[model samples]
Target: MSSILAHNLHLEFDFSYTSFPLVSLSIAFGVWLVWKTWKLITISRASLPLPPGPVPLPIIGNLHQMSVTDQSSTFLQWQEIFGDLVYVNIFGTPTLILNSYEDAKELLGVRSQIYSDRPRLSVAGELVGWNRSLVLGKFGERHRTMRRLLARSIGGKHAQSFRLHEEFAICTFLLNLLEKPRDLKLLLSQLTGSVVLDVAYGHQVKSGHDQLIFWFRRIVQDFYDATAVGSIIVDMIPALTYLHSYIPFTSFKKTVATWRAHLTETIEHPFSRVKEQLRNGIARTSYVAQHLSEGPLDFETEDALKYSSFNLYAGGMETLAVALSTFFFVVTKYPAIQQRAQQEIDNVTEGKRLPTSNDRERLPFVEAVMLEVLRWSPITPTSLPHRLEVEDIYKGYRIPQGAVVYSHPWAMSRDKRSYTSPHEFRPDRFLETPKEPDPRLFAFGFGRRICPGKHIADDTLFLAIALTLATCNVTKRVNEAGDLIEPIPQYTMGVVAHMAEFDFEITSRSDDAIQMLTAAHTQLGE
Candidate 1:
């Protein structure tokens, strides 16, 4: 009996040991199967096609191909090579350029929920303190609040109240042109600055060298220069932003610091003055004074108000200045077009009065010319980089979260599908096909982030163009040797795309025109 029990126990032990090895092998095989499945899924995701683009280099990606001053033109060339949607990598950042209107409208407009966010501009927005400014603010509750306030203050009918400011400013500019034709660009800049100051802070800019104008102009110019693509290396290589403090005598850092200080002052100075005016019962109909009059505001609300006001001041002044300057440059080059515009203005107003907003609808040709000028040279070509807030697939390609997207208005303006003979500056194109999309739609921008000041911009530009053409004959500057030195149609490399400083002759078209401008300026008490 003892021998039989020992044999049975030994058999039980042998069976238990063999089952343990089989169990271990089965467990190992299960883990391997799971891992293989996971890896295949990962590979499938990685293999999803990205948008067509030029192959990037190892580390720098496509940074070498970008130009700091002329990124729009460069992107346009790439659009031709890679079709409408071109993907590029700047360092590790995936940049998607929307070259066509349909693509831009689809991504930035139709699906704005995912594409409304602004790119994190480490150099321009953060370092320069423009993140507080509405133009560069992130997509959030703060942005929404500021945008709503801005829309209420400067949009639609509220924009029309400021038309008097524009009319007076343009009339003053006309007189300045008569006295100092060579200073046409300077006069236009001062006029825009004056109008913006009055609208934003109720402060009249009395001189070209007004301290406020000078500081704001410097701030705007430097901000554009500092924030421009490829302007600061740290923007492309984000790690370097933290390292900036460790390096001694960093010029860019110093510049940014100075800019931040100036920017703060730009926002606070006029606002404080307006508030003081409100407190003293001498407040005017300025944006700040009007808001302050509503009652005391909390810190956050007040802060939003301050930055929103700065947005109006900066955006209104700089963009209008650039657009009006571009008009002068383009019309000076194309005399026949200028003559045609002047004829239209003459027929509309009969040289008895300066052009006003009431005349805008009747002056379709004049409006078309304004549209053409905007299309010919879009002020903000890429319309400030937008960021994808979530992962999205567009046209069978994955657009990962945080990818920088650009709506290339410059390229869209020259689209053959949209405009016939797109490169040529033809105003009649708008009149030809009522169905054809106005370039202004793309020029202003797309989606929820379209320039909030578009109404003000449109009104200001129209008045400037009509009144200037009505009163003045812009011709090439004649040298002492009696030769007409035609101004070169060149543009500066910046966010606003200003026409390069060029010489032109500005003379009153007729005595009646000068009388009309003088009478209008006198009526406005300027």
Candidate 2:
């Protein structure tokens, strides 16, 4: 019955040539329209302008515009010209500079999974074998394993366990300042190196002549030499790293080989010491000792232990010293700030005793001063480069995969948007109503790669600040002619920025402070 109805209604197909022309034209037009739309979208995404950067020159890219010595000021100028995110090409490698908090927070913090990888340092990391250490290690299982090991050893809650190490070291530091105050930098290095070595390995540092300290000094210098900007040709041309043995440049090759050897010795020295301590049944509580206390580990795990342990302390030592040095420099210049800090410590200790870790909560002003120093001159002015895992887009900008990224703590510290009177050294900003955000967040870093030793560094810095203020008065130095030697706030540029040497007088605040310092030193029994 349906067939009969269709037959009556005459539902006919339009397959004739006359109908084909219009149908074909319509289909072709629709296909063409679709192709055009897709082409526009693809072109837009591919050419998203790369976050607004200076025009790069051929081959050299933006390297000509960059001052290898002072990337901080250069990046600051770029931030002024092109907002927060500035992209540049270094040689053939793509790089993105993040000068603002929000941009860094979003990329390095919120989206860390894709932004947590460190850049490949050919000469330093590969040729000199520094890549095994957690700082320059590639992002992968090894890094994760190291992070877990570090977290268990000296992270957040566990950091309090090392209070004795910090206290003992600081006390020694105070005595050194009293006995040999002229070499402040050397004293500080000893202080930091001792504390870190004692905590990271079970190695107790001898005052001035510990072999481990010697190795540390040598290795850190080697690190600087191997990683110096544009100094090693291999870093820019990675392929040269393979030709080290055959390279005609004997001096460079020999230098790199020596650096590699020093790094190995430095990493192994403390680890061997810890093992020896364990074997002799006199192991001190430390990251290495604690791990070794567990049943024996396989080569991979033990290797991870050795390298991660070194990174744990070695990474913090120089940076902590720099932060403390900056603290002294600031106080020497602004005696009022130092006095205020002393007053705060006195309020906590009542001038009857040396300030201890327990007094940390009670000494807010001291904490503020530490924070201010970090903000004034971030130990690491530039964040270690983080390479992107995949190509991405942000704010209509296309960032290519493998584009190494660097966040500027120096820029963030001086950002008017986040700080008021950014140039001023105001500790009150951290304490006053509607307080400023703690600089530690960005200063330490952001995301998965944020400093694992941050907690320990914080605890260590606060104690050093508190103890020094409570016991000593840092003042301007006088020349041979008895003229005032004013300090100028200046810093050296490198991976760890250090305050330039300044003459300052550090002496006991009072007879009581001297007695207390004496008592603490005696308790050390050194």
Candidate 3:
């Protein structure tokens, strides 16, 4: 039967070379087609106005070229290779990494409006409705309102009103660290959380293990981690979202829905509670209550409540935590810096009080330490993504619209053009007369999206560090093997950066230290 089938198939074919020539020609044409495509790509490359970069392959582009080493270091290395302004293709999307301070200033500063937009985080911002979050919103009316409200609530002059809370929060943090030295990270996170929560929702978290605080932070961390990670199959190849539910693997729809539901619940439940509390003749001066009463403004909508809460969670908490972590790591490593700051505090307040916002100007070292802490750890190295709203013509080249602009603080902070010893931790850099560290402003970010919580962050850090350093000395904890183990100064990756945890032992300082800190703490409240 098989032989009969082969015989019949052969009978259908003509064995003449004249007829076979057509098939040969077809094969040759296919090879010629591929060759022509290759040539076209090589020639087209010259015509395209490409930014400075290594050549990229078809489809994926330079996505695979990105190395996920320590994000800052990897970016620095890329800058060295591709020049200050490098273009890398991120899944066919053009990404601009500005390694120079001038380039960042030019793009994000001079071309402010054109480069101030954000990439569409459809899943987190749209799906979870995080557009209401201040940091995620597109540049427009809503963004202006959100930023203005935040600045009013937690920015400059308004932060002064919260000095009492800052004093209490720092004192609480110092006392906890002195008593239970092992739980440093937990205590620091909660201290910041308590202040922001009180500021936003009028809720006071007494401990790091508070259920509400724990759940809120957990959800926030999950959301941020998800936001940072790229799900290219769905993002680059978006049709996967419409896959049939009958298929066993439909996790994308479920995961996104579940996250959005979680966010909605987390954000809305607290607003209701605050409202209920307000109705009982217990009016609290929180951002949430203020917004609720004010109702809709030009920028305020019902969705604003949830997004504002998200901003409170993201902007308010992490900056404080990372700053404290940087302080701890620096103090543990450079005991001299800590001692110098302590001496300055002692001289100003006579070791009888902790430093306050009022004393921030007097204690130059305290201010310096805060600056150095931000510079040393340098959180959010890449800052946040900025999108080009219009084509930017700079340096005789055109930066086309739709480019993803990265304002790399990592590179900027370490630029030789900025600091003398950019890598080393030097508090004195801030004290120099002719030129102090040009404000170390990169840590917070730039333009309209610049962190509104910066003033609060500064106050919180100074008070916390001053109180902690004045009262107790941070040294390495002894391991079970009797060797002192210090925190390895490594960074965690993401849009935000943090010091990796290491066990350190905090010992109570002399009686004078405690007395001075207490006095300073008292002065802070006044």
Query: Considering summed lDDT, which 10 consecutive residues are worst modelled in model 2?
Result: 9-18
Q: What lDDT tens digits, residue by residue, belong to model 3 across residues 290-403?
A: 777775444356566546655776676877888888888888888888888888878887765555677878888878888888876777778678898876666655566798
**Against the true structure, candidate 3 has what lDDT?**
0.74
Give the winner by lDDT: 2
Provide the TM-score for each candidate, comma-separated.
Answer: 0.88, 0.90, 0.85
How big is the positional error of residue 199 in model 3, measured in Å on the Cα after superposition?
Answer: 1.4
Compose the digit string of candidate 2's lDDT tens values, residues 1-526: 9998777556443345558889899999999999999999779888777788899999989988887678888998998999899989888889999998889999999999999988888878877888888888998999999899999989998999998888888988988888888889998999899888888985677668888888888888888877776444567876665564655643466778888888888888778978988999989899999998998998988999999888866688899999999998888999999888788777777878888878778888888999998898888889889999998888878999999999999999998988899999999999988899789989888898989999889999998988888888889999999998999888788787888898988888888888887788678645
Q: In model 1, where is the ten-residue run with the lowest total lDDT?
A: 243-252
Deviation from native of the Cα of residue 524 in model 1, angstroms: 1.1
- Estimate the overall C-alpha local distance difference test score of candidate 1: 0.84
The segments of candidate 2 whose C-alpha lies over 4 angstroms from its true place after superposition are 1-44, 230-232, 244-251, 524-526
